[model samples]
Target: MATTNLNIRTDKTIKEQADQIYSELGLSMTAAINMFLRATIRTNGIPFSLTLNEPNQTTIEAIEEGRRIARDPNVKGYHSIDELKAALDV
Candidate 1:
């Protein structure tokens, strides 16, 4: 079988954390990545469903408000992805 080299850039912290996790799972990082790539190719995308939790009335209202605020043309200085994610406490 032929082998190819692949390079991906990620934050150092994330890479370290992933390495630790894969080690604990008794897998190498290369093996984990290869598994993910094979699954993606087989399904033409990610192999799992991702669904958000059902929002209660208050959560729904907050989401609607956030959408309204985001839609405002005058709104300025949108938060960075990480900042928004932090704000959502996710």
Candidate 2:
């Protein structure tokens, strides 16, 4: 198989970070780029989700807190709307 050079311009910091990460993963930048290209072709798309609906940090923290509360045995749980309302004095 024949190979050719591909040149791209990117932010210096981003390139540095990518280089470190690829190095840690035992891949060259060329190999990582090849993998990404192959996956993109195989999927007929970007090979990952691209979305604008991501939650903010506050929302993420709130979700984690809610999960923690649900799992904590010491936290009070109400059986129904009436019970929850009574507890909240609503």
> Which prediction has the highest TM-score against the true structure?
2
For each candidate, what is the lDDT? Answer: 0.90, 0.97
- Per-residue CA lDDT of candidate 1, range 1-90, in tens? 999999999999999999999999999999999999999999999888766788889999999999998889886643698887777798
C-alpha positional error of residue 77 in candidate 2 after TM-score superposition, expressed in Å: 24
Clashing pairs in 2: none
Provide TM-scores for the models.
0.54, 0.60
Model 2 TM: 0.60
Clashing pairs in 1: none
**lDDT for model 1, on a 0 to 1 scale?**
0.90
Relative to the true structure, candidate 1 has a C-alpha RMSD (angstroms) of: 11.1
